[model samples]
Target: MRVLVVEDHAFFLLGLVTALTGHGHEVVTAGEPYQAEKLLGERRPDVAVVDIKLPPTHSDEGLRLAALLRSHEVPVLVLSQYAVPEYAISLLGADPRGRGYLLKERVAGVAQFMGALDRVAAGGTVIDTELAAMVTRAAARRAVLSPLSERELEILALVTEGLTDRGIAERLVISVHTVVTHVQSVFRKLDLPKTPADNRRVLAALAYLRNG
Candidate 1:
């Protein structure tokens, strides 16, 4: 895959570039948004892996750039240094197809990072489990997650990470049958609202968790 990586931190950028290239992905990189925009137009990469903070203002420039990429029908997977639900929700809320939000630290997990990139490029949503856990914790604070058992809470957090039953089962070292049963139990307990985007069960769950 051809990837456009936008990051300001020199060290992080170098490591990311190395990782992408090592993973057999063609990589184009920029230290800031302007160069990133230039590369985007010139390279026309298959996907973008953007950092939510950048140089100059060091604020939301990366987010704005990601939005522009999305407008041009480019897939984007945003990386952040912190677990901010608002940032994650904002990025994930706008035409979530081919979009994702994950923590910067997750890059160390090469398998996980590669998986997220592939999924986003294929028009899938990927949220960091840490951020998902934050949403789930907030749900508990609001008594929204109170009905779930301990194991159910664990599964629900993974669900927000956009994991399938099989993926969750593998992660928890359990059977897919058990995973399916637990997933059903989770939704049944929470009774999430009926969402128009049937495939976006994660977003629907997030919306309820964040706003409930």
Candidate 2:
């Protein structure tokens, strides 16, 4: 895959470039949002890995870049040390497919990080499970939507992580029937239709991300 990496940290940026190259990807590096924008105009990459903060402003520059990339139909994977649910929410305002939010510390393993990149490149959202949980909890506390019970919230988080009903049941130590019931309740509360399981999960996740 051809990738554009937008990050301000010099050493980490070089390390990421090396890692992606080692994994048989062509990489272009940018230290700031403007540089990344210039590169985007010149060459289209399969995916863009962007930091949520950048030089000059150190604010939402990366968020704006991600929005621009999405407008051009480019996939984006945002990386950050902080969960910053707000930032994730902004990046996901576009199409859910080809979007990801990964915590930097969790990406120390090359294989796992590359796997996230591959998932985004293939048009799948790959949010960190921990971050997703935090976001969901915050949303529940806010009551922006109907509040979910603890068990229901847990099932929703697992659903966002792409786990199967049986997997969620096993992880939560609940029966498959119970998991199915929780899932149905979650969909109803979130106002997500009883469509395909995957679509329901995506819509539920979008609600959690938006309201959280």
Candidate 3:
């Protein structure tokens, strides 16, 4: 796989490039958004790993670039030191396919980062679980979130982590029936629309994260 990395921090960039190369991926490096844009025009990569902040403006240049590239069917995985909910919402927009938002700390694990890159590159969403919890907590005051019990909130967080019903049950040491009940409650309380063709669990989580 070919990947374009856009990050201004030298140390992080070096480590990321090394890790990706070691994992058998071809890497193209750029230090800033402009250079990244130039590279994008010149060569199309399988995926773009971008930092949420960049040089010159250092304020959402990576996100702007991600949004721009997505229009052309480019997959992007954005990393940030902090999980800015607004940026996550905007980067994801309506189409969550081929996009991901991860905390910078997650990059420390080469396997984890590579797995996320592979998923996003294949048109899947991979949001950081901690970030999803952060967004959920911030919106705790909202009425839509108020109806959910603490157990329901826990289940919702697991759902956002891309856990299956059985997975959530195993993690929580509960029955699959219990997990199903909580999931149903979460959807009902959150007023998540029913869409059989879509990944409604993820959509519900995104909606809560965005609105909250």
Candidate with top lDDT is: 1
Which structure among the candidates has the greatest TM-score?
1
Report lDDT (CA) for all predictions.
Answer: 0.84, 0.78, 0.81
- TM-scores, all models, native as reference: 0.90, 0.79, 0.84
Write the residue-wise lDDT of candidate 2 on 86-191 in tens digits.
6666677735678888888756788978977887887777777877677666666678545578788788877776455776788889899999888888878876
- Tens digits of per-residue lDDT for model 3, 6-99: 9999998999999999999999999998898899889899999999999889999989999888976889999998866677778888877788
Cα lDDT of model 1 overall? 0.84
Candidate 1 residue lDDT tens string, 80-194 = 9898888877887645778889889999998889998998898877888888998898788889788889999898888888776777889999999998888788777778754
lDDT-wise, the better of 2 and 3 is 3
How many pairs of residues in model 3 come into backbone collision? 0
Q: Residue 182 of model 3: what lDDT?
A: 84
Give the clash count for each candidate. 0, 0, 0
Which regions of candidate 2 are displaced past 4 Å? 139-152, 161-185, 195-200, 206-212
